[model samples]
Target: MAVLGLQVVFSLVMFTFLHKLAPYFSVGRWLLSKRLSRYLHPTNDELKQLSSGNQPGKTTGQTSKAKRRAEQRRNAASAQADKSESFTVPRNLPIQLDQALVEDIDLVPLQFYSEYTWLMDFSLCSLVIYVLTEIYFIITPHRLEFNLSILWCLLAVAFCVRVLASQAWIYLRTQEGGERILLVTFTFFFLVFAMGVLIVGDNVIEFGIEEGYKNFSTSATKFLEQQGMTSHGPVSFLTFKISLAFFGMLVGTLLTFPGLRLAKLHVDTLKYSQDRKITQLLLQINYLLPLLLILLWVKPVGRDLLCGKTFSKVKPVFYEDQFEGFRLLLVVVMCGLRILLMPKFMQAHLNLAHEKIESIKKESGRITNIELQKTIARVFFYLCVVAIQYVAPVLLILFLTFLLKTLGGLSWVSLFGETAVSFFTPTSKPGMKLPKLGGENSTLGTIMDSAAEFTSTLGDIRGIFTPVWYRGILNFFLWWVLTVWFSSTSLGVMYYSQNL
Candidate 1:
């Protein structure tokens, strides 16, 4: 009961804090305004002069005076034209982040929280139903008490931290693009560390009953045995492998949405002729992809799949076949989509490139072909970096998982020797003597003892080293990233084409 109350309180705190913060973090608005001013609005000086109170016909009104004034006006106009031509326009002009745009940005976070509320409400109701069922069982003399308070606490903490960091990072990026690298770096590190702690500390077991653990462990062991594999202790490797696969699939799916959206926008931009359209598409893709990838793929995938258990001890063959099928389907669909859209994507890139080059040539007729090539190369380099930024972390996680598993056998051997030495001592004096059993008897006895000791001492270590929940985490992350990325990217493309 107390645990239930705590869950409710945590939910309230999270909702309330996010509700208050919803308006302050507005990336979309900042991007929109920046793009608008850069591609549409005239420079500050131009606007200022147009709005200025200075005029030519104030006090003088005679034929001779009028002629002198007209002559003076012609000279002034020529001078102004020269000045305009000489003025150097700023690149990547900063937009004034305002309250109205901030309010517009609030809608997204509010809608997100509103959806979250429905989920929490359903969860709370389900929990009540579960408690009532347990009570009925208890009345019939069945042991029914199950505590999930600690696990709930951990999950709440994880969720809150993830949301808070995400919002903070977004807010910081919009307010000042200067610290984006630092903020994103910090967020990534925080998520990885939190997930590591959650996994290593075994926080997930607190969520359910002891029976749950037994069922899971037994199922895992049987599955492994069926595969002609034997473990000295619990078979956590299968669980971890399944988890990672699921995470990868989920991440892939989640990423697909945004990827598709970006692909579509690139297609549209290719068909369009305006630089504004291209810029808007670029900004939208940049802002949405990072946040979506980080929130949906990075944090959730790691925590849910690596630390949480969603799959019971299932057959490796079942999981492997399912994953392979899903991967094939995903790749096929994505490839098809890419193929269909390839012409548009390429055309958009080329069109934008050509448009930019023309604009530069018009501005400076003396610009050389070599200089243009250098500029194009710089732009392409930045684009590549952006692509890498989103992909590298995911690949790194996959690599680390495999690398650790490959060294698992050596790790076990080293641990075994160290543990045996720590537990036993050699005596040279007195009547102390080691058992002198020979052949199979000695080997069998030693193997059995080693198995027992290792199982007892290294159960948690094995769990930590092997991932058993990655699939779910990865899936959750991927779903989120794809949703956000696709939506935002689409909007950006639309906004640019229409408004620009």
Candidate 2:
């Protein structure tokens, strides 16, 4: 539990720091360009002027003062004309396109091919196999589990088809319009979803069970034993399914921070001409603080505390009571810190966004139909990705909570309490009292116990779907949304004099 807490804290801190550092990183690139300019080749015009012995900054010592002044004025006028035409005269501009830049751009296509194109081919092959196998099963429909297996096969095929279609669309539209950030974001999401389906599909195929559905009792027994925790009741497959959905959603949500940040940076780069160092710094700081806070809260107190056997042992009661208090306190402190920093962060984001919008408006001059369509498409895509990243996990968690209640007779409050305890408690205690089962509880308990035992015996079966690190992104999103909503409402009422 302590390790988990520390991990979470570390991730949050890293994210915060990255966000704050983005602008400075951008500035660093600009600085590097400026410093390297001296090494760049002279432009054609510059070379011509130098070869012709017509240096703008040079004046012969014998030349009359008035003539020199007139020459300077002429040069100034020419420079102004060049500026009006948006022409820049680089003293040491590159004679040829930088090989590194060419490589960077070319690598994007190679990456696209490797990540999406290759995946598409693999999915297509899988779909073909699935279809052929399903048809064979249909022809020999004498089996009891035929229908279930067929459904599972169909689902597998459908997912593969969807993957293929999405990849094709991305490829087709890649040239028409798409930011690097947007493409990368979608690609990552697609890969995550594809990996999940593949994992689940492999499990189903191996078990020869339709959709890999295990009996409730069997699954419950297996899960408890796997956790090395004594089960007083059965576990439900439905409950397990719900948990998996929540887990996926949480993973997706955690992934969104990087995607959103990338999208924002892309948008900003397109929209703003000025540097955004401060804005980036604020974002990085925001990401870093949460992680640091988690680390601070989780790190062992001292050598004495580390050596203490009593402190090292996991106690459920300690997690449920003491850990809860500790978490609550930590949350309060973090929230307070965020609130204090909110004004600065909001200012930076808004200012950068506003500047970008203004720049876009100026650049467009008159928005054409094609430009408008591109803008709308980009907006839609950004919204879709953001919404999926933020809302999916929350919905998944809620769905899991609901399913667990219905199928396992698990109380939502008690389950959360258990989760809290499991997360915080140091591992040492032998046995703890399980939460009481509610409506239709005994039957479910039996099913869960049997399932748990079966799963324990087959270690490979349990390993198929478990995630290494569980990120509670949904929980964070829920809190953030609630905070924003309340804040907005309070501000609205205060300004409108509604309370008065």
Candidate 3:
């Protein structure tokens, strides 16, 4: 009740400001507003002019002279036809692709642009609340009754999942792309992989999920008994692991298309940026960072390598809790790097038009003008959809980590030892009688009394959803997301490499 008033006021003010300002300003729109060169699709006249070996606006005499030169070359080629395989090369055909700048106005009509804007705006709002909450906690000893920031982060994650699922659904609706089958196949594979990981001994993987669940169950059982409710813990061990496996399966399906899209963009980005060694290096690092995060939880390799002697049970370096802190930090860094390089990835995708035009030049057959136009135009048209695929997974992972930090009782500053405090501070000591309000028998007294009751109810709810349970579930989720991301992306990269 002490700090609730200020927190509520701050949240409302920020929410209202964002809600109103969103129309005039948005991070998503701004990101897409960056001007990039786009190739203009060739018109029928242009293709015909190239195919006929004639230049536009040429005088009649110049056209006749050009035709005579072409006829002479064809005669010479025919004279030597018996000596060499016959082929006709179009003369005076130069592919000078005109370029235009793609701006925010161009993206406004693109598919998924609104959804992308909403997602980015919501993510920004969620981040603001989280940062404010953290600052409030740091300065005040009185604890937050219920962290609204957690609610915001949860909403952001849910929204991201919905967007990704919709993207996957688009593939399913097509039915002929094999994408539908791939999604189903990969989901099952991840489910089996999740179960396998869960069954392995903690000595090998070190998730500590089993221990955390045991502690949670015992705590919950005691709390239930004290409240005169009967329970055999919350769920059986087998049931828990099965539920976890299903969750992992969901993550796998959501990430499948994003991973593949990333791989395609990565390969294209490399091709588009052949001369820029630094950009290529960053792309590789961003692609491989997930694997490094996954290895951080592997007991024999990640933890043992850094905190102790390799392949040994010994411990000598920093505290075990610090390892968790470092992992969290790395995820944050990777998310930042991905955001920074988003423009590069997006531009690489946009350059598909140029690439397609170049590839068409290599073919000997004539391409219909409509087909050529669609090839160049669709790349810029689907810009927003591609942006969604790139941004969704990164946002999901970022906010999930924030939820894990808060719910798992971990701290962003765990390395410096400023761990998160308890959720609330009581107005009075335990077992003490409630004091009379400052103004007895008045409206203010009644309001204070109601506030106290509300705070108590919130406290009871927090007790049921304890951090021990959160630690188990969240750790499993974070690990599963990282594992599936690395596996899918690595597979996608290899697939593209071989096929291309």
Winning candidate number (lDDT): 3
The global Cα lDDT (0 to 1) of model 2 is 0.35
**Clash tally, candidates in order:** 17, 40, 0
lDDT of candidate 2 at residue 470, scale 0 to 100: 13
lDDT of 1 by residue, 1-500 (tens): 54243344444554554456434542223322222211111223442343353222322345476554443232223334444343233222222111111123222332233323332333233334334433343233222222233243234334433433443434455755544554444344434433443353223322111233454466556556755778544645446444544443333323322343354445455456356675556544443444433432232342344333344453322232233233323322332343333334433432344445445645632433234333433332222222222222222222222222222211212223454423332223343344644555588778867766775445543443332333333333333334334544555466555744
Q: What do the candidate models score in CA lDDT, each in turn?
A: 0.36, 0.35, 0.77
Name the best candidate (by TM-score): 3
For model 2, how does the per-residue alpha-carbon lDDT over 171-266 read when each residue is reduced to its tens digit?
445655544454456446544653453245322212112233434344555667777988754435445445554544434333334334433432
lDDT ranking, high to low: 3, 1, 2
Q: For candidate 3, give the lDDT of residue 331.
A: 95
Candidate 3, lDDT over the whole model: 0.77
TM-score for each model: 0.30, 0.26, 0.83
TM-score (C-alpha, index-matched) for candidate 3: 0.83
